[model samples]
Target: MKFTTALITALFSVGALAAPSITKRQDTVTYKIHDFTERKYNGVNISTLFFNIESPPNSGGNIKFECAPFVFPTGKTSSTFEAGHVYFCYKDSPYSFSFVPGDAQKGTWAKLNLWQTDSKTKTYVGDVEFREPPCRAAGPGKDTVCEAQEDYQIHMSVAGSPTEK
Candidate 1:
């Protein structure tokens, strides 16, 4: 009985030491848009904009955008308006702005678009667009090389206003 108990305890100790604990951190990113250009449209100044987006660590092989209007020229007479379609690019990926409005389907890809807030709910308005990465032809009889390529870009952008939750 003593021998069996000692062996069991030793086995348990070895099992505990061999076990590995893996912790997964959540990847949530923040995006901002700025550098609004004032253009004369019908004698009125319209805002043309650019964006800066920060990707969270461990982006989970994807980028997400939530669109909403922002309060500009803050305090007393802060103007709010709906911004138009935004654009993004990833340096590591070979994807283009080929995303369409819809959920992800097989071979379907997407990116985020920022919009204005809804007056009633005080929530930002926006939609997600799916897109596919650009394709490249492999060298003669070299399918393995083309198939192994991966995306590595690390930046994204929009046309007007910042988008967040």
Candidate 2:
């Protein structure tokens, strides 16, 4: 009976030791507005603009926008935005962001065109493509440095009054 109890205690200790850490590594990336316009298309307010990027801690040392275009349709008109805010967060490493439309625009989204640079020569680091959707939920045990997936969330709002249109 004592031997059985000892074995059980040992097993419990091992299980406890094998548990993953609960603490998370968090960082924020900010993109500032370079330009924006408020216009009325039909009767709806449409705002589009470009933004400059500020580098995050682990973002290949510097920040620069890649030349990938995004296409979207608003009601009867199709609009293309050359630039806007691109916010990204990573747990272990490797992250991607794809745009998702709000309640007003359904089935409309954009994918970010991203690339890593040489850090010195300011050249491309091989070829890195953005593949994941923005603000998607992440799973457990995914917050590792060697893993190629990370979780992210987004918070956004219109800057002007509704009556301005």
Q: Would you estimate the TM-scores of all the predictions?
A: 0.20, 0.21
Look at candidate 2 and give me any clashing residue pairs: none
C-alpha lDDT of candidate 2 relative to the true structure: 0.28
Q: What's the lDDT for all of these models? A: 0.31, 0.28
Which stretches of candidate 2 lie above 4 Å from their native place? Answer: 1-49, 57-60, 66-98, 104-165
TM-score, structure 1 vs. true: 0.20
Q: Which stretches of candidate 1 lie over 4 Å from their true place?
A: 1-25, 45-47, 54-83, 86-165
**Best prediction by TM-score:** 2
Can you write out model 2's per-residue Cα lDDT over 100-151, one digit (the tens) per residue?
A: 2223244443333322222232321111122322222233432211111332
lDDT of 1 by residue, 1-165 (tens): 999999999999765433322123223223332221222222222222222222354743233332122332342211222233332222211121221322235654434354322223233333343342322433343221111123223333222336332
Error of 2 at 15 (Å): 55
> Candidate 2's error at 58, in angstroms?
9.6
Q: When superposed on Cα atoms, how far off is each prediction in RMSD?
A: 20.1, 19.1
